[model samples]
Target: MTLDLATLFFVTVFMLGLGGVLLLFAWLQNRSTTALAWWGAAFLFFAPATALFGLRDNLPEFWSIVVCNTIYSLAYGLLWTGARVFEGRRPVFLGMTAGSIVWLLASQFSFFMQSLPLRIVLASTIVLTYCLLFVWELWQGRKEGLMSRWPVMAMVGLHGLFFLVRIPSVTSLPFPIGANSPASPAALIMVFGPLFYAFALVFLLMALTKERAELYQRRAANIDSLTGVANRRGFTELALRVIARSNTDKAPLALLLFDLDNFKGINDRFGHRAGDRVLVVFAKTIQQTLRPLDLVGRLGGEEFVALLPGVTPDITMDIAERIRDSFAAAAREVDGHRVSATVSIGTASATQAGYDFDTLYAVADAALYRAKQKGRNRIEPGRPSLTMVSQALES
Candidate 1:
């Protein structure tokens, strides 16, 4: 059974209204995701805009055609604004209203008012621009790795393509822009396409919000709040996986254990705020020194760890030395204080320690203890145990 245009319009209004309320309620639960509020408002606007378009024959041309279509444009503009807001960009109020302004201005022209195809093209182009803008904003934020983002992009892109197709297909429909009597292919697309799109996008947008919240929760669990590095739990989880991979490939790995020298003295002397600054400084230094693939984490206060895969013992020693020197230099003046903080690092290679996180960690921790005993701000290499030595001799 086919749906008539009037019934389709009613369904669109009801669905859009329901979708709008759900989105707004979701926004109330999490005010940080302001994109939901904007998107909700856009859907609300569509409900009334669809109603006005449906009642075009009974209502005045200004209210039904011009104003209704202008609301449509504004709604699409709001969607684009929501996309920008989702990616932490400022909403362009003027840009959001520009489509409505353009529609209103063009409606005043006699030539524009008389031509049905021209009106369809202009309206479609306006909505298409916002659709493409939404896609572009999402594309720019692809690094965030949200699963829902891809489908939203594809949906908006296809919706935009539909509008582009609508421009050329408008020639086939009857003139004067009355109610779709028989509902031609273009008319059916006009009504049904948005109906389905609005329905699907509501669920997709909710999924996007859920995915982001989950991602943030995961990050919070794993990341050090003070230093913005992986915490102990996060490091352990990631490092173990790396170790397993190294073992499988028979590739070498290195672990560097770092401890700040006289951390308690610095905290007691300068206060905890200054101590925090020192930690941040050292964390930043190590992250800058290491490669992107390298795992750098703050195990706890004044202690950190780095796991480097596919690296030799000599290279690990060099990296540890570089990190030690960099932290010492960088922590000299942190947050405008005379915080001459220094780090002691211990290096361990998988060739000696074996490709197990626990084994590597034990060796590195022992080396760290040695560094503390020798003095502070020194790099020490872990010595292989007798078992490892014997295995090496046999090999």
Candidate 2:
């Protein structure tokens, strides 16, 4: 079988196009992320597109070899960006890749490639340098707890180097590192290159799919299916985390628990449809008023929780006031009429007595009970619950 670079270029095009489609899927499913655009651009223009067209003019020339190797290098580098960023690492790979590709391109000068003595000296040197670099990155990934991420990348990197130097004229140069050996670079690459990179890409897609599925499972576990807010499960999770962090950091956090006033009457008079609309509208209201950094979740029907981190009592009161007014302002219009509802918020801060996630939830719950008992449409806080519990315990 006669294997040529043309066949190689054709197959990479298909793989790159497939990656572009998945990146689009990621962009649409979540909020706008910059990585999606970068991935799309890399696949569309750099990887196979350049290889297909750029290789035509310079076939078997140094530049053709350079272009093909550059694309593969760049693809590995671009693919590494996803590997790093998706797991929250600095974008250092882009700059490093630019430097590496630049140096490799600069070596194509006739003087550089022609010097038999210099070529041999530099060939071993360049090989060692890049091999060390790949090893260093692999070590870093393992140390940083990124999970089994480096293997796929290492496979891409090693195979890429194999494909790069295998250009007919170039493969023999610098005393032909692999040319003199029983195993030829072209033969080895033909045996493994396309399929190796293909396997790496497949591995990456598997990693991405696994990540998305895990994220979905985590979200579903914490969120209410009907209301799309944190359910009791999520509340326990946030509480444990906030409590553990608060004890360590000693920074103030707060929780506001509340329920709508006269909610049942609306359901009784207007129907459960109106009540559900009120819940959705209320969730929307709380979501809008609070900073995106804050977390809000519907605990159950008519009851909600807003976890506010780093807020003092005074600031929290101001927030509570706004939430109260914001909800009243957010009246629902059904079948041509404005239907009004009110809320009673129980607010508690970390610095206060019984200042913890559970205590805050309890206090807020007690305050809500009082708000309903004392007539409704108001705000209360956590001290009341602690006091009642203390008295009951003493009694």
Candidate 3:
């Protein structure tokens, strides 16, 4: 099919303009990272670059060859900068400006400015470098598990390869070349490739933003605001998964339920703000005493749970005691006030308490109640009785 360059240019300009607007809107809504703003600028810069190319016949040779290409180079550089920012890396402004600098200096030479193939080769090399760097930046963030990132990387990588291949073809092929009208296969690809890439890239960018939003929402739902531990719902979800894994692996699992003793009294004596500090300190102490693989969560105010995999009943009790002692020592002073606090922990093992989360939780809760009844600031072993199971089932 015979492609109309003017039509392609207009379509590309419109697509780039629309994409830029959408990205800018997304930036305004989130404002979390500068990556979105850089990408928005990329699209906006690209629109005018494409427009300048379309008007090259009408404009001066210097504007068409030097200025237009410089802007185009800046667009690709910003794309690279955006990728760097997304990956939490500092954007190198000098590296981004290098391509434009090279083009501007090279354009001053009459011989360099006169040869279209030489200019295409230089511009293509600069753009390809930026594109590859963008791919590298995205690849570095692979562990984040954002699936949309893979497609964006693939698209940019392929785009780079297209330019890489074009360098050789443009150098070899003889075609009509001028500021106003450049009839060549490379020129056609240049116009059409970015149009398709821009469309795909905009959608992928939106997908990335959506993925991040969903991740934040999930964390907010599952995480305790004050303690920075798992919330009740998150604990249940994670603990259930751990239970299933333990059952399959035949590994012992233990659950420890903890409640702060005289937590209400502490709040009354030291104010709610001081009480919050005590809770934070207690949570940190619990985290320090456990293995990295172990999971801890906040059930509610002054109530927490810890799940330990591959632990025996005796070892679980010892760990619980350690946590209790550590928290008790740590909570002696909250916000420089003489606020004393202690934690009561009740532990249950999978072998004795059963693998079911609800059953185990009920046994632990019962044990916790017993510990409170006997005395605060104590660790108690859960007794998984048939009555407890029945009660859990009923509840």
Candidate 4:
């Protein structure tokens, strides 16, 4: 079936309008990502631009050529701005408006306005620039690991290539300005191409948003709300992976379990708020003392764990001591209440405690108990049981 210009124009408008409404609904559902709002507006602008293109023959030259193309250019510019916002970059309002400004000024020249080839090249250049800018913005966020980004990039890239080829194709064609009728081949291809592009992009954009939402949901589940560290479940999953890797590589790994000393007394004297501040301070201190490769998690109230890969028992002991000293210093006073906080740490190493997280945690927990029994604000070492060694080997 042959697609007439009117059919293509209505399809383009429908797709753009549908995309805009869906994106607007998405934006309303989650107002955090401003990119969605911008993209929604872009699609809205594109719907009108497509409608204006279909009505160009009935409208004045200024409305048909200058206003119509300017709106179309602004639509792509908004898409570029949305990409910039997605990547945490500042949107260029003046740059986005520049296309309309340039088109309006150029349309004032009768020769430029009357020549179809010149008009096509000029509009294509502006649109192509915005398309490439969108590509660059998405490419900048390549490290984010969004699976939908690849298809979005490919679609935008090919759209830009279409405009790029249009520059030369229009220049070589013998078509006149009046030849852009509903039945013309060029008009049909131009309208149909964007119709397909817009529909595909809407799906891809929704997929991207879904991917980000799922990622954030997973992180929220894994993260401790108060301390911003890994929760118990997250720590176990990550630490076990580290343990498995260490066992495979035959690298030394250490586990340190820590509990804040006199935590109950602080909460009783100063209140739970002060207790929370102390915990936050101690967690921060522990994070600062450890290497980036180390994993730390809050096991429960005032209880934490750290898994250190590539560290021996002696070095792990020293690191634990450092963490203890730093936390003690940092937690000396919370909200100026004169609350002195200290942490007791237990150290165990894979070489002695076996490579399993459970075995290491058991030894470390025993040593932590030993530290508490001896005195608070101290470190203790625990030896792995023979049973743990056999279990680790079997596993």
* Candidate whose lDDT is highest: 1
Clashing pairs in model 1?
Answer: none
10 residues in a row with least lDDT, candidate 4 = 174-183
Task: Judge candidate 2 at residue 23 and give its lDDT.
Answer: 66
lDDT (Cα, tens digit) per residue for candidate 1, span 215-327: 99998999999999999999999999998899889899999999999999999989999999999988899999999999999999889999999999999888888888888
lDDT of each: 0.88, 0.63, 0.87, 0.88
What are the runs in model 3 whose C-alpha is more than 4 Å off?
A: 1-3, 174-185, 387-395
lDDT of 3 by residue, 152-245 (tens): 9999998898778768787455442222344567577667777996799988977886896787789899999999999999988998899999
TM-score of candidate 1 on Cα atoms, chains taken together: 0.90
RMSD of 1: 3.0
Q: What digit string (tens of lDDT, one per residue) describes model 2 on residues 1-395?
A: 65565556566666656656666566567543544544554555444634544354556645444455455455545555554455445567655376346647756697865554454344334433444454454456454443444664565466545534443344454323333333445443443444454446555645644555576678798988767878877977777686667757877888888788888888898888878888888888888899987888877888898888788888888899899999888855643446788888888776773344556666677777877788877876656445745543343
lDDT of 3 at 197: 69
Residues 340-368, candidate 4: write the lDDT tens digits.
Answer: 89999998999997888888999999899
* TM per prediction: 0.90, 0.58, 0.92, 0.95
Q: Which candidate number maximizes TM-score?
A: 4
Superposed Cα deviation of residue 156, candidate 3 (Å): 0.8
Candidate number that wins on lDDT, 2 or 4 = 4
Q: Alpha-carbon error at 74 in model 2, in Å?
A: 15
Clash pairs detected, candidate 4: none
